[model samples]
Target: MRNIMYAAVGLMMTTATAMAAGTPYHEGSATIIEPTDERNPLAEVVSGIDFRKSMIREMQEDEFSNPGMIVVDYGAEIWEQVDGTAGKSLSDVWESCAGMDAATAAVSYPRYHDGAGKVISLEQQINYCRETAMGAEPYKWEKADMLGMTAFIRYQGNGEAINVSIDGPAAATYERGKELYYQRVGQLDMSCAHCHEDNYGNYIRADMLSQGHINGFPTYRVKWNGVGSTHRRFRGCNGNIRATKLAYGHEDYVALELYLAWRGNGLTVETPAVRQ
Candidate 1:
């Protein structure tokens, strides 16, 4: 029965990939989703929330009902508290580095880091500050503090459009990410395009598939019973396909985050989003 199930899945993957032929980005080795200026109607980018059930959407819309708010509130507290050998808090450094507020700094992420000499995700930036400026231990990935912190930052950018850069040095990373999205992985032989790109709005068992946009991170998930980061969600997707999961903040995952963020282009930030 398991073998039959795997076969069926393989067939689905092949069919999905074939059906997506001639489509941009996911179709061939070409990486550009579309020009930065012009929008593609065929690849209409929509927030994942649009595909969510109304109840989930309602939960995301209302802060009182949104369980992720609790995490964001916790993060706000963390932002103010001082820590590390430098005797600084995220707030202390915010004024010096991240520009006026978290909200303004939130939309730009998976950016190229000169020191790191590679693209890094928002979560990594937080940790970089902790290690370099704060002189503190970095928070573990997907944990309460990490989730709360990212939720807080992302929430500040709420309603803003996602605007990550994949130009110059970041271009290689974006290309790698685009490849990862379409590359088949694991025992099921499925890629992100199989479920999100091709089968979005289609049902896989009880849950409906979405376009898999990452405009919302540190989102509250009913299945998780709490807010989680995009990398956490990526790990879950890999696991779902029986693929080998990488550690949190892995370079490939960071690159993939860039691709996903760019794919989301103008979608409004919906941090602490509710998903089932």
Candidate 2:
């Protein structure tokens, strides 16, 4: 069964590579579904991927299947715990989504809103609910409270696929995000696709680059050993392209994420809040 799965994965990689050549994605190597850096859509992964040791594959094993579940548990703990002037938990402020499905949410996001008056990231919307409906002070963007809440809430729909919409009023943000993805900026004169789509699966020193997919983030990265915000990863990529770094919760990032969510339509979301 293990070899079968590996073989299946190998087939998927080959198919993805072959499909990548004919598809409309040729910026850098775009990653499809593998964890290695070399699995890019742009170029074939050559030399030294350690495919014999796939962390993502290992995570699928029963021996280590609880990472996603773990983060969700911690998120639940923090949600019910009291904090702020009202000293109320998240349940106190808004509709108690204490045990609701969160995993299905990633795809529904990067949506448009006429009333809110701007594009919103899923993270910001959650904080908005906690602060306004619950009357609690908003948690810091990088706070344990935020990360925990994100992990817990989003873990609800783990196996479900992504479903972002760009046609509604929210389409404007998506449009902006798409432009940002292709726009050349920074001193290095690079775009997001310069490396990700065009270079897809190649090596960068110890790393085997994969396609740049946003669907699986708030991902539990092995190197970081924790859940990290998509924006942090975006910033790192931006810096790598020699672009000026944006603030942690900048609007540009919100726009970019909206675009990314759109690009990664139909993919599954594995939020970082999940236990690893």
Candidate 3:
């Protein structure tokens, strides 16, 4: 069954790559405009607003209308439920270690842990907490439960500034991530900076490009009809570029997440952000 699923994913990725290769953006004919220039014709008109449109934006603002909140609610339940050999809930373990609520815990994530001996994302830390504190098996990266729990935890940090560290143990990994951002790959010979940095506030067909910041993930993408992690979106973008999509929770993705978080250091946390 697992092999079948892997084959299905591989097939889907190939199809997506084939489709993307035909687009003008992939063909290198799409107009690239500067995002920083207010006088640039595309500056005012092109914005991240294209991602959610208006209706989804309105829906996102209303907590009751947002479907993603269902996952958040479920995550809250998981936070308190006792499981594993340690027989403790996530909430209990976190509170004991950090002396704070989950919301604050969410803010200081993708941090370097002495015991883990590396920098880890909030999602990775959650699984670590589960395994060590609760003596439970770690949830799969693509699992719905993991998404739900992550959303719920991140919700607590909503509106807080992203402050991922690049010092000490995180320094080397952070550099690698920065390199990845600028390293050109795939048949199109594009790096992340090509579209997001050099050509931000530009149009590729009807779609407008932004800096591709990760401040709002795990975002609720309307197109997906569900909340998705940074790594999941990374895979989609990689597929679009006809590049090999890395597995979820891979060290490279985790390192990339760290660098991206630092890139948007001053931005407010917008987990469960609505996107098209």
Candidate 4:
């Protein structure tokens, strides 16, 4: 019932955006990049950009035109700004952590941490670093500081292939996420698979259903009018299904993020992607 209403509203809004922008409601697949890795369940893992209008794709390609860059810029400023009792910034912590480059580290998120002894998403990692290494207060979930920093970090991984491991210590968490993906809840009684897995590429009113990949997360949506974290997007989907919204940085959502990252193992990172 509510799901149907949300679908209708989304359809109308998508149509309106297309009409106002003078672009057609649907775009071609010229921008779609096929996955090089073979672990993907689908024959070809496509980025959200592939499903978006050309105008939106162009916005994502050009840093200046992409609205999400504003958040990235803010994050860049915060990266070097001295803070906390330790007087260290994110840059300092990264420099000390095994000398790994930020771009290489970005795609390996939602990873299992021995210290935390559980799966932690990138946002959780940021907070962990701040609280422990920088002796600074952690940013609240979905807040400007968190979102901006997340986008900035993920942006560094642009064009890098996503390759999160679900084996070993993270296997159990991955299985839980798989269960949640297939589990039906809310009044609509639809699971994530109902739309993303079974009906991708099909039209739900004016909008085309996508494979529900998160590789381009911290994405900017015209509807949102600002950048948002992947968890924030999860909350939106849960709302669209009339489900009880989970708090940001929930363990369950983190597990789901792990599962989705694994599912998109071969897809290229396109952080701060613009979507209609």
The candidate that wins on lDDT is 4
Instruction: Give Cα-based local distance difference scores for all models.
Output: 0.80, 0.60, 0.73, 0.82
Task: List clashing residue pairs in candidate 4.
Answer: none
Better of 2 and 4 by lDDT: 4
Higher-lDDT candidate of 2 and 3: 3
TM-score of each: 0.84, 0.71, 0.79, 0.86
In model 1, the worst 10-residue window by lDDT is 23-32
Lowest summed-lDDT stretch of 10 residues in model 4?
21-30
Candidate 3 positional error at 60, Å: 1.9
lDDT over C-alpha atoms for residue 16 of model 2: 57
Off by over 4 Å in 2: 1-53, 60-69, 82-88, 92-104, 273-276
lDDT of 3 by residue, 47-135 (tens): 23233345766776678887778888888889899989999988878765444467776666677877578888778878888898899
Stretches of candidate 1 exceeding 4 Å from the true structure = 1-42, 98-101
Clash pairs for candidate 3: none
Worst 10 residues of 3 by lDDT: 38-47
Per-residue lDDT of candidate 4, residues 46-125 (tens digit): 66666666788799989899999899899999989888999989899964542346786678888887766788888888
lDDT for position 215 in model 4: 91
